[model samples]
Target: MGRKVEEVVEVLVEPIANRNGLELVDIEYSKEGQDWILRVFIDKKEGVSLDDCQSVSRELSDILDKKDPIDKTYLLEVSSPGIDRPLKKDEDFIRFSGRKVDISTYAPINGEKKLNGELLGIDEGNIKLVVDGEELNIPREKVSQARLAVEF
Candidate 1:
């Protein structure tokens, strides 16, 4: 049910983002506390603004109200992905190469489930990361989640 809502929202929101010169980063639908929340992550090369979020929320709200896709009431949220934005696509890996990243795998690789390092970008079908003093190559298929990591 959640997955279906996400799919629908993604389809509904992508065009709206594009029309507004925003990149659709991701969409998430999940039960929070006792309510369902639908979050839409948006971005741009110049970064996003409060006005951008407000515009998207207002425009999308009208569309969702008309379409009435979800059976239950859900809160719609639109915002920027921020500095720790998730790396969800091949392009994201390329775009964020050389940045620090945290990667989590569905299964342990090299006896590790999580790795934090400098992203060396994707090669072939694997992701290369410079961890510690060594380089680690993890298959993209093995990655469960990945996001930009702040170095502090």
Candidate 2:
């Protein structure tokens, strides 16, 4: 059910995104507390605009009504991924090259699950980071979740 909904949303959203020159960051359909929420996170090479969200929301709403994919009620939200955007794909690493990031793993990498360093981006299938003068190569598969790190 989850995958089916994601696929439908992906199909419905791509054309709208392409037409508007926006990048579809992710499609999420999940239970939030007691309510089901459908969240679409979008981006652009430069950034996303309010008008961009409006355009996508308007187009997607029409498709959802026509398809009636979900039987139960769900809140639909279309928005930008924001400053701490998720690092979801290898392309994201490439795009965000030289940005600082925070990543955790399923198991420790060099006895650490948490790493905060400059994102040198992906080299082959590994992510390169410099931590305390030591260069570390973490296999992509080991990453649990990663995002842009906030600097103070």
Please provide TM-scores, in order, for all candidate models, with all chains considered together.
Answer: 0.95, 0.91
Error of 1 at 34 (Å): 1.1
Instruction: Report lDDT (CA) for all predictions.
Output: 0.93, 0.90
What TM-score number comes out for model 2?
A: 0.91
**Could you tell me which residue pairs clash in candidate 2?**
none
Tens digit per residue, CA lDDT, model 1, 1-152: 98899899889889989999999999999999999999999999999999999999999999999999999988998999988999998899999999999999999987899999999899898998998979998999999999999767
Model 2 lDDT vs. the true structure? Answer: 0.90
Residue 41 error for model 1, in Å? 0.5
Mind giving the per-residue lDDT tens digits that candidate 2 earns over 1-152?
76789888998898889898998988889988999999999999788889999999999999899989888799999999988899988899988888899999999988999998889889899998877778899999999988999877
Find the candidate with the highest lDDT and give its number. 1
